[model samples]
Target: MHVPDGFIDAPVSVAAGVVAAGAVAVSLRGARRELGGERAGPIGGERTAPLAGLVAAFVFAVQMLNFPVAAGTSGHLLGGALAAILVGPYTGVLCVSVVLLMQGVLFADGGLTALGVNIVLMGIVTVLVAWGVFRGLTALLPRTRRSVVVASFVAALLSVPASAAAFVLLYALGGVTEVPLGSVLAAMVGVHVLIGIGEALITALTVSAVLAVRPDLVYGARGLAAPLKLRVGGELVDAPAAEPAPAPARSPRRVWIGGLVASLVLAGFVSFYASANPDGLERVASDKGFDKSVEEHHTADSPLADYGVADITNARLSGGLAGVIGVGATVVVGTGVFYAVRRRRTGSGDGAGSTGGGDRDTAGSSA
Candidate 1:
């Protein structure tokens, strides 16, 4: 949920900004490792970086499709679990952060002043909690595709309420209105529970879809299946592993193109059917009488404000065009950031003589 400008006191907002900044810094470092093939598989820096960018754009598009949750309330994908499962936790945090930044600056949906608050809740908190839960569940469950999908669902479901609790804690410290702490917590948590179910379904479905096509690309699904074995005479023995094949050059490109097409379609056309009711946070704020504290967004007059084009007369066409533009912008910016991080990692490896020219060639071809 996006916190508006005046919802939190300036002191608390500034403090949250510091926390958000630290989280992003840490994630950037962590993402380097993940994208560099140190955390998942061999085709990393090249493949994972572009996939992460696509994930960010996909999240941005999906977040626009709000589904009805409860009476007069709707909920959309938070995308932390989906991103973490497909990419990695660090990159997942960055993905959501990118979406939030785009929403605030271009769509004028989230507040610019309270941007830190939104990042803390939707980006950092969601990624950390969801990743933890997913990892824990995967450890306990069978190592299979089904298990990973199950873990994704549970992780996504819990992450939503966890984020809501974080917001409640923040409000307890810096709320601008006189709403009772207990009432606020109850309302936020209760409504968000319904929203969590939707989040769970979306995360599970997306993870499952990706796994069916390209399980190697799914970070959370890595090592889920044991290596192949051979039966020699009467005894079973570990099969002699074949040399690692250089990743096919066009596999990631195919996936990226497919994901981008889906994102464009979802944002440009499917979003028109999204429920018009207030989302979980907005509904909770209104019910608790704290919505009065919200200040108008400074970017209210932006060309793409509120997910609509400024001059388009048709509501559907205006919103559709804005959504397409948002997806395009998010993909470009996200790709640039991830590629920069990937390059930094490669540069460091080169300086240390840790990566050979062959490895670099493989990575480049895969990209």
Candidate 2:
């Protein structure tokens, strides 16, 4: 959930900002390992690094659909579970962080002042808990696609309330106004528990869909699924190994294009039907009387504020344009960040500048 401005005091917000910055720094380094070196396969490009950007755009799209969870409360995709299951944990953190950044700076969904709080709660805590639980369950369960999907479900189910609890803990330390802490905790946890069910369903479904198409690209399923076995005279034997890596079932470019199309459709059109109700956190705040302290966003007047373009009286057109713009922006920015991280893993980044300069000097001397 987006923590608007003034929900947390300046000091606590600043502290959260520092924590967020440190976590992002650590995640970036960690992500390099997950996205490291891929000699182009049939796709003929970096394997998982580019997928990070697609995942971010997909998360941004799905989050626009706020399904109703209760009478007057709706909940959207936190996406931590989905991202972690599809990509590695560190990369998952980066994915969600990118979405948060885009939403804050462009769409004005989350306040810039509370960006750190949102990232800590929605990105870091959720990814940590979801990945941990998913890994634990995967280890104990059978090595099959079913197990991965099951673990995704259970992990997603737990992550939402975990995030809510984290927010409560943060609020306890630096809430802008006094509301009954006990009541706030109970309300947030209770509502988010229901939201978690929806989260689990969405995460499981998406993970299953991806696994069916490209299990190799799925980080969590890398070693979890077993190879095919053949029955040889009543005995099961491992299938023959490939000389090189098994080829992808489909083209990576095709998958990327298909995913992008889906994201665009969902955000641009499906989001129009998303319930116009406060989410779990906002509901809790309003119910608890602490919402009065909530301040207007600095970017409230931005063209994309509240997910609509400025001076655009047509709801559908404005929202659709905004969603399309958001998806495009997220893909560009996320791809740039992931590409930089991936390049750093090549270990040639530090010397590239010097190498280029030397070549230029040599050319000049010859001339």
Name the candidate that leads on TM-score: 1
Please give the TM-score that candidate 2 achieves against the real structure: 0.89
lDDT of 2 by residue, 168-281 (tens): 999999998988899999999999999999999999999898889877667898766476899999999999975866665455666778889999999999999999999999
| Candidate 1, residue 246: lDDT | 75
Error of 2 at 365 (Å): 36
- Against the unseen true structure, what C-alpha lDDT does each candidate score? 0.88, 0.85
Cα lDDT of model 1 by residue, 122-178, tens digit: 998888899999999999998889999999999999999999999999998999888
Clashes of each: 0, 0
The weakest ten consecutive residues by lDDT in model 1 span 358-367
Off by over 4 Å in 2: 37-45, 227-250, 349-367
